[model samples]
Target: MTMSLVFRNEKFSPDRFTGCIAERYQFINCDFSGCDLTDTQFIHCQFYDRESEQGCNFTRATLKDASFKHCDLSMNNFRSVNALGIEISECRAQGIDFRGASFMNMITTKSWFCSAFITKTNLSYANLSKVVLEKCELWDNRWVGTNVVGAIFSGSDLSGGEFSSFDWHSADFTHCDLTRSITSDLDLRSTDLEGVKLDSDQVSILVERLGIRVEE
Candidate 1:
């Protein structure tokens, strides 16, 4: 806490910030709904809106196990958010839309399971097109130009990620670890590394971008 709660243009109603613990807050144009915000934390918060591009809404929010440290949450909307087990560390969360965020937990109706931790976040240009986040932890994120056409992130760890103009053929990352990630373009001949885990200098920089010369 330690002062700094602003919450301008507020519209909260529904468990109003349940289990709260905020710090350094601002949250302009706030309109959070259905807020349960279980185990909420939220340190160094801002929730963006630098004169309009819109931010801070959290529509249909539950935020099951919220954390959100060092937050800015740029351009935030978070439609239909349930955010099961959410964490979000060192956040900037640029361009965050997270369409209909759920972080699954069905257990029936075709049994489902997903959870989020989202470490060291920047999440540049975030949209997360078809989010699933299979076995989630999501370490050291930056993900510049991130849209993730049909995101799955199967057995995810995403170790030390940056991923410069990331496309990786619109995302599924089976059994992913992506050790010390900084994949400049990740074109492993059309990308689809079965049980992905690269390291060894990122497989010699993705086999020298397919020119191949690993004579070591």
Candidate 2:
């Protein structure tokens, strides 16, 4: 069969799209909600201006510049994929894997990526607002030129991560493990650090900059 996207409408909610293939198809300004795209493959597809189907797969595929908006993507797998310039808004993306993914211009707003396992991912120039990343693992990741506004990373593990020139006023690292994480000019007011593991130097820096008391 030909690899082309079909059936895109406002009222069309496609469920059960198992084993379908749509490689490198352009889906511009389309709406897909309450759909099931389990086991479907969209290799290198371009969805620059469209909301995502409620249920979809992006597992181990190349989705550079795909925009997903106002969808429920709970228990989805974005494991080991390259999704650059992607925009996800108002969605539930619980338990997704973004290991080694590179996002040069990704933008996400009002989205929930709770308990997602992200390792060595590159988030360059990504904009996130009102997004919840609670209990997620962001180890060894790179947040270069990322602008996080009103985004929460509570109880998340950010050990040995590099955050260069990131906007910290809008980013909430509440109760997250930032042990040895590199950051500069971060204004953390509402963030909690009760049990966060930090080295001596990092602890001293936090105490001087944030005025947080360290318990011996």
The candidate maximizing TM-score is 2
List model 1 lDDT by residue over 100-134, tens digit each.
Answer: 78898998999999988999899999898898988
**RMSD for each model, in Å, please?**
12.4, 11.5
* Deviation of model 1 at 139, angstroms: 19
> Pick by lDDT: which candidate is best?
1
TM-score for each of the candidates = 0.36, 0.48
Tens-digit lDDT track of model 2 for 1-216: 232654333333455433455555544434433344444555545443335533234444545444443333343445445544344433334433344444433247654344344455455544444455666666776676665576677777888777777766566676677777886654445444556667787767767786676676
Which residue runs of candidate 1 sit more than 4 Å off their true CA positions?
A: 1-8, 14-28, 33-48, 52-54, 57-80, 83-102, 108-122, 125-132, 135-142, 145-152, 155-162, 165-172, 175-182, 185-205, 209-211, 214-216
Over all chains combined, what TM-score does candidate 2 have? Answer: 0.48
**Shift in Å, residue 63, candidate 2:** 12
